[model samples]
Target chain A: MSDYMKRSFLVALWFVFLTFPLMVVKVNTLKNTVEWRWMNMLWVAIGAFVLSLLWRWALERRQLKNKEAESGEDESTRLGFGQRLLVEPKLYKPVLAVLFVATIAFPLLFDIYQTNIMVLALVFVVLGLGLNVTVGLAGLLDLGYVAFFAVGAYTYGILNSFWGIGFWTSLPIGGLMGALFGIALGFPILRLRGDYLAIVTLGFGSIAKIVIENWEEVTNGAKGIAGIPRPGFFGADMSITSATTYTYYLMILMVIFTIFITNRLKDSRIGRAWMALREDEIACVAMGVDMAKTKLGAYAFGAFWAGLVGVIFAARNTYINPNSFTFMESALVLSIVVMGGMGSIVGVIIAALVLILMPEYLRAFSEYRMLMFGAIMVLMMIFRPEGLIANVRRKYRGHKVMTEDVNA
Target chain B: MPEITNKLLEVKGLTMDFGGLRAVDTVSLDVCTGEIVALIGPNGAGKTTFFNCVTGIYKPTRGDVLVHPPAKKSQRINGFKSNRVTTIGMARTFQNIRLFQNMTVLENVMIGRHCRTTTSILGAILRGAKTMRQEQETVNRSYDLLEKVDLFKYADEFAKNLPYGAQRRLEIARAMATDPFLLLLDEPAAGMNPQETRALDELIVRVRDTEKIAILLIEHDMKLVMNISDRIYVMEYGKEIAQGGPMDIRNNPKVIEAYLGEEADA
Candidate 1:
């Protein structure tokens, strides 16, 4: 190898080494609290970093070589299927469906102990799909989306426990409450832009948690609301003694419903409005799309899905505390959207499952879990920043404003 | 088509102010039954702002825009608020092309039909017969529009992948899909080559003639504007300096000054 090449390899090796220490420091800090230690956590993190860096380096090197090759050769030929699938359509349904089905079915069919884990995964999927409408399609970043989820859960829990409402009846109320608050939250932040909007949303989510925690009369304070009854499908009540079967079917129903609604919205005029707004609000408005109405619609619809899921969560667990729906929960859901590929439904589903299930799979390395999660997210941001699907839809008819002179 | 009538659109004293920088100042214009009126201006001449104001994007600082439907159509717009201009009978394109990048070229046009489609949430969910028919018709109309734009082969393609000129054409098709009586095209010939511009001129003429739709076009292409327009309005620094037939606009000393600077008028 040439001198420059040797220097680059050493630099890559150095960067990989640096990441290991960072992981070690994080692992140590987390270990102080959780007391769950796996001997290989640090090694695995380091190995992943090295492998990722090497893969990236190899790709970069190949790209550079290709660039050189293309300088003397024709590069206009259409790419092969494998090239298209790997580079752009990595999150395409056919390629991703197997992993997604496995994720949904794994906890149900095989590991009963991890049923709660799947519940959480499915919850994030609902949340991601919810946020996807606002953030992915509409280009509205809501850091406080968890607030709506909390509202839905609490609304259902409080109504069911006090008013003796059934789980099914409470579902709508939860969705309504979520939509109401989503609208409520959206209105105040409508005029805000970018980071300012994000901050306000973050604050909104925190406020929801605080309200749930402090409102002892309604929510039972930090002790949280308990004995939140599970749903009875076809008048047959579900109990924990049944080992999560009823909830599984209910979750499947919800998953299908969320997917259906989201898909419909994605293809509809309203969906186009959202995308147009995302691309360029000024252009969208000029196209006769009512910006306020379209944005409000996204917020409302996203909240409804989140709220519905929240109700299911409360029902499935038969308990909920303010602690359960914290800012972290919101962050986790947002991360799923980001990791899955912001606008790809299948990507989001897989991302939610992988992130949710990874913790369970590494229960032995509990202390390093959050650290590893953070590392994966950071790595993803650096490398596969588009999330798993990354705006790779076959034909995007969404609005885009070309700033270049149209008269040119 | 029903008997075409007078006063398709009326804009009176439309103005826009972005923090005391008046973008469009007291710009009043009109498009009457099936006529092509051109808004010609230099760069930063506020033609787009005028378009935005008429489309209800910017609540005009001070203006009244009224649409008198083609007589046979009842006052279907009576109870509606005046500021919501497009719901009445107007549709517009941007100075820059804006097509939803993730959707198919066909789907992009369907979005323009939002105001007309009566498909309810239930209809959408169930794919009710009427809604399905409407959707099929919409798809067909989108195809027809693509074919007219000579972009039928690109119907299934993502709008983002289309070449620049094709994208501009797609935007026009999308705007037309709204079934508007009046179409506002902002800088429609901006990125087009001479051949494309010539074709666009012909297309614009055909659209006016065949569809019987009045067009208010904002174009910097002087040749195309002078060729296609029945009447022209020249504006500079947010104000209309000249308004008349192509010859009047071309010969006006003040219009020349606005474009070629003060020395030309002197």
Candidate 2:
């Protein structure tokens, strides 16, 4: 099926799923008060879902009709600036920019829930950027990057609880630990390339998880760490009780910092080195690039970011258990890089945001969403293996004056 | 004293063995300042094996490659260490053009300047003015190299996308980007037509004279070798059969026998 039709079908499935939870009879309240099921809640949810589906379907139909009408017109017509932007640009950047700006200004304009989702999106953004350095730039297949994320979380948890180290101090230390582990993981697998490398890295990740689980002396085993300290600035506690406003602002600051640094690294000499290595290691060595150092740099840098974000993740949630940093998490992050378009910073961000938020928007579809998502991935591979945002080097070009601007 | 120009690269008593078969046996040669030398021989004559030994791709079983960069003390180069070779003022192209398939044509050349790039962690983060200036200069230098080889038009094009002739020229341009004193070209005219080969001969001569870079090329084309080389070393069965100017070697009976027979030269 066409992407438009598939999207509608997904929306319909989401609508049915969203309303299913409302069928539950009675629910207990937090204050020990009796709470009765609200009648018509399912009906209302299903109605909303159907309405959303129709609205989305209508938009798609309208877009298709407009496309047909435009195609029937004369070919000699010149494209305007705004029209060119719409057709030519990858929708991710402008959309993300808008979302970013909105999230920053959200506390003033929107409610708390919107701000929370923004925080969630920001976390995935960091993870996606880190994965991009590994699976995208270095062309290393890492099916277990979240092991480093777990290391960061446990580092923060243990440091704050035992050593009295604040979140601020523990963050860098956590990143360093991640780097150490990353190097260790990278060294043994240096000789293994392609699929062999993937399997070994995956094995390393499982070993990390098993160690975390069994290391009851440090990790507290099945029961995860709780009451992890939040970040503080200028001796002012950044706890929820201190100020919700400051916490939201801090999240924004962190996301912006991640984006800026990732963008910088993506265009720098080191970034180019990574690309050279990915394209051909033999040629890269011939160009006088030290293979071991370059590969290690990717591992260390990627793990560092994941580690840093894990620190924030621990601080934000106030609780983190071993179960949270599973292979599924790594798979989700890897998929974001894959679906976005490998070796693209902007592409990963879009993938993270879309893939992360998809379940949230359609709560009911969360269960079967993965199945449909897998199907989409399969179809994408068959049709556009370049990912959702194809031709990262340049956008598609139509056979008109409109072609020049989009491609550029 | 003829200036007593220093030897940049010296290969002494080099031997490569494939099990019991000795490909290159005790072959020694010196490449001094500003000379175009050709290593010519019949197929399976160990010309390439000798080139590989000197370029640090293959460790000789019993010999040393001493590279002295214009008054610097000599240092031994180990095998399969390309970075060391590049650092010691040597750059070489493979018989099979090994350009990065996905990278841009400009990127391929810019990678040659990797050894010269000296940016700090902070510099990369801020992309300091110096870094920008250096990067621009590197780009400019790469463009100049490409222009020298007449491939400036395909600067942004992917390396693999170029036509075969352009790819060969690009390989030469990439080698030139390293600013090496010795540029090794392995079978550069291997698949070229007569017209292209003629252009390559002129290009090589121009590069030798104008760039002041010493070149050691391996070419099967006798016409190319005879016309361009200041000196040619003829090889047979892993040993240097004869080494002299093209005319002297051309008239040598040993070279004649290696090619046809002893009676042909007589």
Candidate 3:
């Protein structure tokens, strides 16, 4: 009787949480009239109740299926052909070939405006990949990653405006500036771990934002620099429409470079050291890994890509501003890394497109996107915490299959 | 200078204090190459504290720890970081095993080879000739060490998946990968059954004989210590109680009193 009462009470709480916003808030019309819509509360409450009941039912069914498997009712341990093919070594080349062709042919099929949207998606992909090095591989939680991006963008923006230097030279210079900032910021907070590290990096973003906003002599204050030059190719006229195509090609090349380099590092000695550092700090020290150096390596390498991406962002957008690199931008990049499996390269690419680009089509419910992200993250923590595409580093089965992220 | 070619470790008046309490007080010890020295004591007798001091986990409040690698002059390694201590040819295992639990058995051993090889970020991404050779050598040497500990069969399995006794052996194999001149084992036979303890006894002797390395171990298992150790040191209340040959220390009355009479006196 108590169990039933508890379940009913929880259902009521869920209904209240799901419907209260709909009940209390009034929408403003174009003519300046505000009215409460009470029916929305009823609809939302019913929806919440149905979803909760379905969730419980599904969980019970899954438990039953697992118990049956453990009892030896199911004997087959072999994977089906389709499953095997996905993991097979011989099929990898062909699958990659298809993806390669599709990436090149994709933007060409769409109009220029559509291609710009795809390029924006690609930019987020690079941002997501850069953050993955620290948060995913080395197990450092970095909340203010946009500071690195901002530093990269502002470096190129200032250099181009003052010295009249073009895109090609600023690319490396911007990356260097970004890496310097990554190392500088990482040094003070290197001793701090996890949530403390997150807070410190959050403070760093605000510091960088304030510095750019107040320093009127160089940064031009809040108004931001203007008339930055774009990229050109071999006597060809680089107009507004063609610049998008040029950047699209450059974006594809850069993503490929990041992927190839990251993959190689993942399997190297330094890669294993970073992972060992994450698994247990004491063990890492006892086994002869320099903690400071390895951690700084994660920071510098991760920031390098973010810096490079910032340069591309400046070149393609043709103008840059402080408003562009906000805390919300950092949150969006982090969401990509989390929604994708941490340390999984392919997962970041797919997640960036789904999370960033797909939101454009849902104009009616745009404000609810952050709310849905919050709910999805909560659900992911409870159900599939390793993420949608969990990257299994080594082909080893431990005592039991672990479901949590690297720490667990 | 002390003869560098014969001795593996030399500690003089090593002391460690935590605020008001002295955990290890002026404990002096030495281990020659190819010799097994056992440190046995009651719980909190500062045996592990002394190990931490020599292996660079904790800096000693006073005195020196010198490592005499083969053919190299004795170097005073006081206050060196733990990782650098491994590079200077000393490796240690914890009382509670500290294997990289998530890594494969092979990768755990490979990490021990960290100080022996060097690679840059450029070398890692390029897969050039020198980097390939370094990686291949790491793999081969790691596998060989795993074979020495008789854990080659479970190389691909995660370290955490190993059985309790196997996990202990895996820890030893990982420490040995640093190519240490002196290996420190903290309670190697703490939770083992008699049969497993016997295997560990033989394994320790084999490690000394085959690898030509000296070992300093802390063990409560009297049989394993007496059967394998060339010499023994006993500690009580942060002070050295006795030191001599294993049989001589075992028969000493003070040693017996420290073991059983402390509670009676209290």
Candidate 4:
């Protein structure tokens, strides 16, 4: 180990030990008796400092080794999966087949409880991708994205209850209604940028929730319209278990559809324009992109999926209330987009799966879940502020601009 | 497409006021078909402000600006939005290169083709034959523009990853993708070495000749301004000091004193 790093490690240890009295020590008062445990502080300081220092050392070592390896190697001859897929296009079919098989067998592989968790996670994957479009691709930093979710749920719920409309009929109307709300929300906020935009969006979400809570005549107020019909495909029994593997299958299909559209949009002109808008609004306008159209498109498209997924959420539970659509829901979707890295489509999916499922599995550790979330976020910001899975272009774009002239 | 006989751009008494100060003081200039016009001034001389007036970045406090696109009739274009200005065949590059930093080079150029193409959200979603063809053509045209600027090789690379000189060229390539009849370049040669400036000089001439587009550039680089420009409009303190050929402006004492010092013009 280098002497500088060793000294740094020692300094870290010394600083941690010095802070034990404040950071680790705890005092408790029980029935007028104040008990202090400085021994607990000493042990905690020693354990935590040692573990952290070791982690830092290992991380630095791996980074240093990676740098050396990269410096020594050339990519021209490397046959990684990306290159191999290019070399043999048929390789993708097998990969797709495997995924299809896995998705088909997922419910059977797990018990009803676990299957329910999988369905919920997949639903979030859809929601996360939808939010990803607004916050990730458009760089809009939306705080009120859940408003669209609620609108979709209510649209479906009201139509199903009053109009006797089936899921198939109301689906498009729900999405279109969600889209209209998205456009409505987007219109006023088009001129606002960054933090101001974020605040306004957060207000929009709160407004939607408050309206749902207080609008007793329409939404049944806090009681919420109960007995919302489940999605029925030609009278096939919709209820099998908690999620009803049928709804799970249908959700998987919806997720696939969302992926297809999102993927298509990402590589298209409108997608490029959205990216330009995110990167530099001035440049986007100068480049002749219709800012109004691009911004609205992002909001509508994002809200479409959110609305669709909201229908699924309402149907799956056969009930939804104002409590289901909350700020925390928006925050969870936004965090998935953030931790996945802004503009990373696949990263959002992975993050959505991990984030949604982690809490489910950690119900025993529910007390620590939020604390862990805060710690993870803080550490992420401190260490890899870029993201857990940075969009490839974003990762590559930060490479230092070349100075030497090409013609010279 | 050849440049027709009509003047491509005509700025008549364009004045821009910024809170009691006239940033651009009645700057009248004209660019004929296939001409290269240079708006030369030292820092704070309102050259960019003048460009902004014409390009719709700022609505001129007062004055009439006219644009005559080939096949289109001449029309007063004051107060048109920047995108509207672009659709009328006026595309511009920033003095500070504003290439979408996270986007690929090809994508950056492709964005410039946005106004030229016709694709709504439904078309984009469905990706029907017409939209597909338009997209493919846009890709092809962007590549062609990149090739003209000698940047086709770096098409897949992020715009921000390019060398400074390459980035400048990329900005020009992006602007050219708009298919503008009158291309406005804001200090295209800024930060460029002598060799790169010479290359840029050749590029301006080439773009004007091949594209048959009138070029207007605001530049501090006297050598480049003098070398490529058919006519130069010298401005100082928000007012035009001289408007003539390079040699004519070089000898104009007011132009010499206001901006181009004896050492600079030499």
Write down the lDDT of every candidate, Cα atoms only: 0.77, 0.78, 0.83, 0.84
TM-score of chain B of 2: 0.93
Error of 4 at A68 (Å): 6.7
What residue runs in model 2 are displaced by over 4 Å at the alpha carbon? A1-97, A106-117, A233-248, A390-408, B1-5, B18-21, B236-239, B248-266
TM-score of 3: 0.90
Tens-place lDDT digits, model 1, residues B1-266: 44335667777787788997999899888778878999988889898878766776666777776678675453423223322455566778877677787666777776777667766544565666787677767666777787788887676677777888889888888888878888889899998999999988998999999988889999989999999899999889999889999999889999988889889845
Q: Predicted candidate 3: what Cα RMSD to the true structure?
A: 5.4
Cα RMSD, each candidate: 7.1, 9.5, 5.4, 5.1
**TM-score of chain B taken alone, candidate 1:** 0.91
Candidate 2, what DockQ? 0.23
Which prediction has the highest DockQ against the true structure? 4
Clashes of each: 19, 1, 0, 0
List pairs with backbone clashes in candidate 4: none
Of the pair 2 and 3, which is ahead by lDDT?
3
Query: What fraction of the true Cα-Cα contacts (under 8 Å, chains A to B) does candidate 4 also have?
Result: 0.68
Candidate 2, A1-408: lDDT as tens digits = 366456655665675566645553445566766454555555655565566666676666767855865677521123333334434558546965897687767777756566666667778888888888887888888988999998898999999888888988988898888888888888987767899988988888888889888998889887988888667777874445344455667767876787788667766667777888888776677777778888888898889888888888888778988888889898889888888778766667778888888878878887898897897677567544556553233211113324444778
Question: What ranking emerges by TM-score with the best candidate at the front?
Answer: 4, 3, 1, 2
lDDT of 3 by residue, B109-215 (tens): 88898888898777899999999888888888887888899997788777877888999999999999999988999999879999999999999999999998899
Chain B TM-score, candidates in order: 0.91, 0.93, 0.96, 0.95
Q: DockQ scores for all the models shown?
A: 0.18, 0.23, 0.48, 0.51
Chain A of candidate 2 compared with the true chain A, TM-score: 0.72
Residue B9 error for model 4, in Å? 0.8
CAPRI-wise, candidate 2 is incorrect
TM-score (all chains, Cα) for each model: 0.83, 0.80, 0.90, 0.90
